[model samples]
Target: MGLLFSKFSSYLFPNIECRTLMLGLDGAGKTTILYKLKLNETVNTIPTIGFNVETVTFHKLTLTVWDVGGQERIRPLWKYYFPNTTTLVFVVDSSDIERFSDAKEELFSLLGEPELANAQLLVFANKQDMPNAKNPAELTEILDLGSIKNREWFICGTNAHTGQGLYEGLMWVKKQMKA
Candidate 1:
């Protein structure tokens, strides 16, 4: 998937390289946001392996966003991309309170690394349109993002399947990088 980016890196996305890293487990809407940024036609969800990279040009900044696998078995690979990331976005399934702790732990461990000390963190409380989904404040209380330095974070309720909240999320990432 990223082969195209490598080919076009010279002419297309000329300046940026350290892209935003996005990680969450399966059914967390990572891929959906990927497609939304790509202006892709949303269809059946495809399972990601180690990860997938998508490139989008927002004005002069060409964002090479990496979507890491969120499934339990594939999580170890998440560390590989975390170090050089310009920003880290942790997407949470707001409806799943039972698994919130697991998500928090994974995110904490990732952000704890010295390499990521300066990275911006953005949390997407996704699937907000769902009937059972909880709000951003509830998710924020569970994640406790206040401690992190460069602590710019947003809790945007999103329905990735419909392309809502995707732009706001992307724009937030851009803002973090600029700041």
Candidate 2:
């Protein structure tokens, strides 16, 4: 049977699959980060109204990442994509300091979802290349990342424009997935 073959294939190949959800407020660079990870190049992106799914291989793990629309009207759709998600990658516009509270609220709300209760959290404090961008330490404070409990989580500073800190983030995700 199919189950036996799946188990055998997994044992022989050991290529694990991780379902990851990438989310953020509108204009937070979630699409940019997804493409950068998928293509290793920056591609022009408009607001994602529905979602973008891409499979990225990292350290023997195949990450099927879902980058959903973050606009207020579309945010409600995010929950429909939450089931079976193994990792939640949140991209934040660190330079847009005015929206830190909004980001924190949305992040905590998503974490509260029962479907994603087992999901590991990876927070990308993105736009770190901008002069006004907040650093990872500052973002950790503003987002109140320390208050997160019952889930493994990490925060990394990143610049999707030049592809900095993205792989480091993936490395952490990979470790968490393996654990």
Q: Each model's C-alpha lDDT?
A: 0.78, 0.93
Model 1: per-residue Cα lDDT over 1-179, one tens digit each: 58877878757645544478888867788888877767746756688877778887765567788998898998976778866777777889888878888988988888777777777787889989887788887787878776655556677777788877777877777666656
| Pairs that clash in candidate 1 | 24-70, 25-70
Q: Point out the worst 10-residue segment of candidate 2 by lDDT.
A: 170-179
Question: Could you estimate the TM-score for every candidate?
Answer: 0.83, 0.92
Deviation in Å, model 2, residue 71 alpha carbon:
0.5
Off by over 4 Å in 2: 1-13
- The runs of at least 3 residues in candidate 1 whose Cα sits more than 4 Å from the true structure, single-residue gaps closed, are 1-18
| C-alpha root-mean-square deviation, candidate 1 | 6.2
